[model samples]
Target: MIRIGAVSYLNTKPLICGLRERLSGIGKLSLNLPSRLAQDLAAGRLDVALIPSVEYFRATGYSIVSNAVIGCRGPVWSVRLLSRVPIQQIKRLALDEGSRTSAAMVRVLLSEMHGLSPETIPLAIDQTPETVDADAILVIGDRAMHPEHGVYEEIWDLGDRWCRWTELPFVFAMWVARPGVDTTGLAEILQASRDEGLRSLETIASREAATHGLTNEDLHRYFVENLHFHLGPGERAGLQAFQEKATALGLVDTPKSTL
Candidate 1:
């Protein structure tokens, strides 16, 4: 079996819908957090994995595979900043340790978009986002979509922020495989699965609505409006742009990005 690392999150459900059955003969999938998945891929525990795009730059000998991706044209509801004050006034930023890419993106935005460089603290799984000392909190994944976010004075949608700044979409994750891994025919399966999942989004909404305490309509809209899956030409350009910005900030030491 070809070991594959998959991120366990709602946004990813669409990309992997019916994926196991399709790749049952060639793929053995293991689901984990984005950070762990990246680690597994780097250690050769996985042949391929869907990883935070920033991580693809950390190591060599990998190639991005498939047009399938987790991205947004604008306002991805799940990756956002909840702040008690305007971004410019932020003095301390708490970062959710769940995903490094989102954290780095927020840092880039904080410096380039808002022109503020605050002390950033890593928030543990049990830490509250509304800590007294935190002026802004970068929360990602399903937690960012929670109803409690309404209490924040400012809600900065990072995807929309990226689009506003760059006039391009933002790609959060991509599938990468170790060098020489056979990707032939896999891209078709990956993209096709996303198409199939999107076509049946209502069903997914119905099934997962309660998991996040969202109404079916709310969940359905999230699947339809807040997410974009295809990694087309535009997304590639956005990906390159992101790499350039990330590289510029010294977040990446490689001096160049290949994928």
Candidate 2:
């Protein structure tokens, strides 16, 4: 049976709705941090994983196995950068250890937009933002949903920043498989799972809102307004642009091909 790994973040709910039931006999699904999922996929512990987009570029023999992705056209409320200093003046930054793609995105934005390359330290998953003593801190997933109490120069929703700056969508993660894995019919299964999640957004929001310290309406709006699941032409273009930028920054290698 196929062993699949997915992110444990609320943002990933839409991509995995009813996925376990659908894969009951075909595969087993495990929830983990995006970083962990990537590591697991690389170590051969997982046959398939919803990995960070940057990991896809860095991996030597991985292939995108599904069209469904976690992306944003405009504002994505879950990935944030909180700064005590101005954007151009940030000299020290703390990156969320649970992230891979977002960490790369933040670096790319800092380099391209502000022309600043700051010293970055990892904010361990068990540590809170308040505990990090950097000029700025990047946080992703559920913790980012609730903004830090003290703020200063900027609070950037990375998705909003990328979309506004590039005029294109930002894809965070997608289903990928290691080399030699037989992915027969996997794309269709993933697509159907995404469809089921989209259709059940309201129910999902209702069930998950309070757990994430958000109102049901707020969560629902986030799913419908902030996020996009399909990897259409626009998304593919954006993904390509991102890869190009990341490659130029030496964050990842040039991807061999598309999904």
Candidate 3:
């Protein structure tokens, strides 16, 4: 059985909508935190995963399924940097362990975009704000959507920041398979699931609201307006830019074609 790993977040629901119902006879599918998905894929515990983009760079021999991605052009509210002071004055920053892509982006932004070398600290998934001595805390996923309800002095949307800096779309995640895994059939099934989710967004929103504490409207907006699931030319250029910056910063080894 093909062991496929998927992210357990509200943003991922649309991509995997009706997956459980349709994929019952296909293979063994597991829902995991995004960080764990990368580790599992590297360890051979998973054959394929919807993994963070930076993790794809860290590991080798992965072929990305065509035309599928978890991405956005601007104002991705879920991946944000909450700051106690102005961004220019940030001396230290806390990064989320669940996201390698965002962490690398932060580094690239600080160095290439902003011209600052802020000290970066890696924090656990459940770490509290008090644990950070940094001026800003970077959080990703559902937790970042609300951020202790008004505790932050300013919230910087990473996607928006990237667009402002590079004037291009950003891809946060993708469906990747280990080398020689043969994801042709699996990719078609996943595409069908994504299409189903897109068609019945109301149902997906209701389910997200019930489980993730987001309102249906918020969930719907996030899925429909805020996030882009398909990888297009602009997104590919953005990915290439990110890879270039990451390589220069020594965050990634090299850039493989995502075409």
Off by over 4 Å in 1: 147-151, 255-259
Q: 102 in model 1: Cα distance from truth in Å?
A: 0.7
Clashes of each: 0, 0, 0
Best first by lDDT, ranked: 2, 1, 3
lDDT of 2 by residue, 149-250 (tens): 666678999999999999999999999999989999989999999999999999999999998889999999999999999888888888888898888888
Query: Candidate 2, TM-score vs. the true structure?
Result: 0.97
lDDT of 3 by residue, 1-259 (tens): 7788899888888888877777787677789888899999988899889998888777777878756689998989989888888778888889888888998988888787668778889878888765777888888998888777666777888989998889999999899898878676787888888888789888888876857788899889888888998888898888888888898888988667654
**Candidate 2 CA-lDDT value:** 0.92
Give RMSD to native, each candidate.
1.7, 1.1, 1.6
TM-score of every prediction relative to native: 0.94, 0.97, 0.94
**Between candidates 2 and 3, which one is better according to TM-score?**
2
Best by lDDT: 2
Superposed Cα deviation of residue 31, candidate 3 (Å): 1.1
When summed lDDT is taken over every stretch of 10 residues in candidate 2, the lowest stretch is 250-259
What would you estimate as the lDDT of candidate 3?
0.84
